[model samples]
Target: MLRIKLKWFHSLRLQLFVLFFLVSAIPFMFFASLTTGRIEAYFLEDSKAEWMRQANLVVSQIIQTNNYLKEGTNYTIFTNKIRELSQSEEVNARIIVVDPLGYVVADSSRIDLNTTLLNTQIFNALNKKNSSERYEKAGNFIMSTAVSIIDKEDNDKVLGAVLLSASINDIYKLLEDMESQIYFLSLIASLVIGLLSFFSSSIITRPIKTLMKVVQRVTNGQLDQKVKLNGKGEMAELANAFNHMTEQLQLVDQSRQEFVSDVSHELKTPLSSIKVLTESLMCEEDVPVEMYKEFFYDINSEVDRLNVIITDLLLLVKLDRTEIMLNINETNIKHLIANILKRLSPLARKKDIEMIYEANKEIYAEVDEVKLTLAISNIIENGIKYTPEGGQVKVKLQSDMQDVFIEVEDTGIGIAKEEQGRIFERFYRTDKTRSRDTGGTGLGLSITYRTIIMHTGSIQVESEEGIGSTFVIQIPIKHV
Candidate 1:
């Protein structure tokens, strides 16, 4: 039972319920107790006043029979009068009359006649010049009152004193009944609040529980799972964020799978060529010298292709890291583009394509020379490769106060509009068959995109399926 209680104590629902109950009920209980005490004091004071009035009437009667009281009368007439007063249903009290000597002359209960009254209040009343009343409390909710009895003709003559002892059990009973009602009402209020708290807690926690379940499914590799929440506060915002995170995770997972497939396919092609070349050489023993040289040259070319693929993969991994560092230098943009075009002009000449360069005399900027060169080279090389014979490959460089713009345009087989957005994605090709025939690894544009982005630059493509493509590259004048 203790263990179960401890377990319940750990629950948020129970804690919330208990907290709400205390917040609501404790003040009510405190006020109820305060009200009860005030009422008890009021009733006690009122009861004392009523008993004092009754004692006054008895004192008046004693004075009416003052001659008998002074002559040592037995108080028979006084006893009869008090007995009638005491028997009334409204008063629950004992009446006592004390003589001048502080001795009990009469008691309404009729059991202590002639007993010496040593009470301090009775002695104090015997000395008072006029009628006086004082009260004290005892066991059984009893109140004792002492009132001085005086002669009506000479109010200064103290003949005797009256003592009224009253039991207030009925008043106490009323207080007890009221306290019980308060306790009962408090119980009902706590129950109602607890019920409301339980439902309110449920409303708050339902979305959290659903999110936990969806997270569990995602942890188990269910990337497609998502949570739907109808709530209209923080919970709804949290659900939207959670769904967005899951969507990004799904995209990352899909991209990873495609990366693995592309990597394997890229590696397999060159490896198969090397294998076939070696197998041919092995089959033909003592082959011709020129045939051997040609086969060895072919094998060496495939190895170089394999090396290029590995080098690009390594460069991409380095670029993906958060700690990538660039060697910044102030280089003339026009000179850089001219150098790239000059290096690639031989490849263009092989296809009978014309290379054209247009730029300002000098446009210097702080940039990573190697990375920017690779990015620009890939675009111009693609332009030269894809353009038909006698086509023009144009390289134009322009600059503003803040940035330098490089444009590479070619009269080549342009890309479709739909494929332009994903052309920068790794291992994506507009025409895979043509790309492969032209020895394009499909990673050049991806590398170009990453390099340009690292320099805080932007690249855009404008193309139609049959028209030529224009590649625009924008580089910042200074690193931010």
Candidate 2:
């Protein structure tokens, strides 16, 4: 249960959403509170300052008006003047007068004086001096200001003080409106930021999800599938890479399938032939003595072909190991071709096909002589089998001081241009229908290719359909 809960909490979309709100809300809350407090405080202070400025003006006029203050120590006479000042449009504020000993002598509000003598509003106003302001919420929210006064005759002594207060209900209302605006803005901003984060995270995770699905399909052996993406961003690049990987996988899969199918087919044909020949021999009640040599020769030839195919397959396996190296020797090209042609000459003569050799003596090359000879021999035999009766096949060896050349040129039905390049691929027969009649396991050229590569040499061919073929082998002196 704990693990499941933890996993749910840590899920990508959930975590992203939580982080979006968390990152957006905390700072927004802090800034809103700070800004609102500052604005509200500013409004309150301004309200108090405005009220105090008005109070200073009214008190100045009252103290300057000696026409109403000719009395002795009785500040009540100024009440009518203060009341008139409080009621003025220019100074719409309430006024109060108090003695230094803490008694309310006069009030514009006309509250009961004896009962309000103990009021701190009057006492604190007397205690206050200069020009400053404070706040109160008596009857309504109000700002208070105080200024001291002196007697006209004895200007050195503070006779009494003026207390002024003003209502600031509008300021409070303005602050409340500002807070409401901030609340709405914060909510809207949070929602927008959250949606942006959600979409960004989804955009990031979507392509990865698609690539994972492609991987799943590939693992299940669907190699022909390709990814299609139209974006021009990082995701598109990743998709392209994934598609390239799939392309390589498809080619590898095709190669493997063709290899297996060809192996089975090749093996079955030879096995069936051997079985048929053996069965025919066994069913013979009285085998002719003369026919025995032909029978055994045919069987031996079949066995030789099978052995060659197996040997070539094993050689390919060993070479594929990445650790094997060829045993190199400096071999004579002219002598090599001559010996091969001599061996295959009987087959050529049986069909009345001419075997020709062209040589430039003193041709030497760096090679694994035995393997090189096998490759050349295979090429020679291929040409012999394909060449028609009376058609000419040539084995040519020509050399210079720089390199040696071996060429097997045959007058026979040649290969198509498109199929020429794949001739060196293992078990690839260009004409599948005629593969058996050609007496080939299709591993001959593949083996030849590997052998030539091991010798650090090159092989190329030029052929015209229905005309002839000339396969050229070029080898440099001094093994590299």
Candidate 3:
């Protein structure tokens, strides 16, 4: 049980429950206590006032009886009046009539007769002041009120004093009963609040529980799992973000599968061609020298194609690392473009494609010369390969204060708009037949894209089908 309770303490629902209960219950208890105290004080003050009024009435009656007696103190009449007043239901009190010397003349209780009583209330009455007091005696709460009795002949003269004392134990009992009821109601309210807190906590944690379940499913490789949260709150926003992340993961997984399939197909094609060529050579006995040379040359061409594909794949893997090694140098941008054009000029001449190089100014920028050259060479080479005879492949180099831009435009078979977005993806080709015939490995642009990205650069393609394509490269002037 202890362990279970400890575990529950870690739960968000339990924490919220405790928080809500305390937040609500504490203030309610405090105010209840304060209100109870106020009620007790109000009752006490009201009782004291009523008792004083009754005592004053008795004093008036005593003065009237003395004036009727014409001269002496009529102890019998005073005693009967005091006894009658004490037995009355409205003022069920202990009545005592004291003389001017503080000697009790008449006592309703029939005890303490002719005794000197000099309590605070009785003493105040003798000095012509009305007063009331409360105290505890014999385990009973008591309230005593005293008022002065004056002579009718001389109002200033003190005739005697009448003291009314009552047992207010019933008032305290009534207050105790009220306090019990209040406490019972408070207990009921606390129970209701606790129940509310429990359910409220459950409502709050429902979304979090759903999120946890989705996350668990996702961890188990179920990338399609999505959290269905309602309302536009943080939780809903989180759900949207999580769903988007899963979508991206799905796309990456699909892309990876495609890459593997393409790699297998690419490798298989060259190996199959070499196998067929070697088999033809082996089966043909005493074949012509020209035919034997032709088979070997075809075999050599397939092997070279395989080597290019493998080399590009290795380069891509290297570029994909979290940290790519770069031999950063401030190289001439114009000179680099010229060198790439010069190298690919032979391929261009074979197809009668004109290679053009234009530079606005001699710009220099920080770059890894070997990698950048390879990337740019691939683009220019592709332009030369795809362009028709007598077509133009134009290379331009220019720079701003912070960045250098390279543009390669070619009058080649332009890519379709829909396929342009994926041109930089590995093993993705716009025209697979054309790419195969042209000895394209389909990794050139992918390598170029990654290499440029490693240098914090961007490349964009602008193309229209049947027209031509323009490739724009932008790299920062400085490497940070």
TM agreement with the true structure for every prediction? 0.63, 0.52, 0.65
Task: Give the residue spans of candidate 1 off by over 4 A.
Answer: 1-12, 18-191, 230-237
Among these predictions, the greatest lDDT belongs to 3
**Model 2: residues >4 Å from true position, as ranges?**
1-198, 232-241, 280-300, 330-365, 394-407, 433-435, 456-458, 474-480
Report the Cα lDDT for residue 369, model 3. 97
**Poorest lDDT segment (10 consecutive residues) of candidate 2:** 1-10
State candidate 3's TM-score.
0.65
lDDT of 1 by residue, 1-480 (tens): 111222332376777888888877887788778888998888877877787787787777666654666766655776777776677675557888778888777778978887888667887788772232334355467777788877777877888887887777788899999988987788779777977997699776667777777877787788899899986789899989989999999999999999999999999999999999989989998899999899999999889889988988998999988799999999988889999988998999999999989885699999999999999999999998888888989988898899999999999989988899999888898777887788888899989999999999999999876669999999999987
lDDT of 3 by residue, 77-120 (tens): 76788898898997889998887888887889968887899877
Candidate 1 TM-score, true structure as reference: 0.63
lDDT of 3: 0.86
lDDT of 2 at 469: 92
What's the number of clashes in each of the models? Answer: 0, 0, 0
Ranking by lDDT: 3, 1, 2
- The C-alpha lDDT values of all candidates are 0.83, 0.76, 0.86
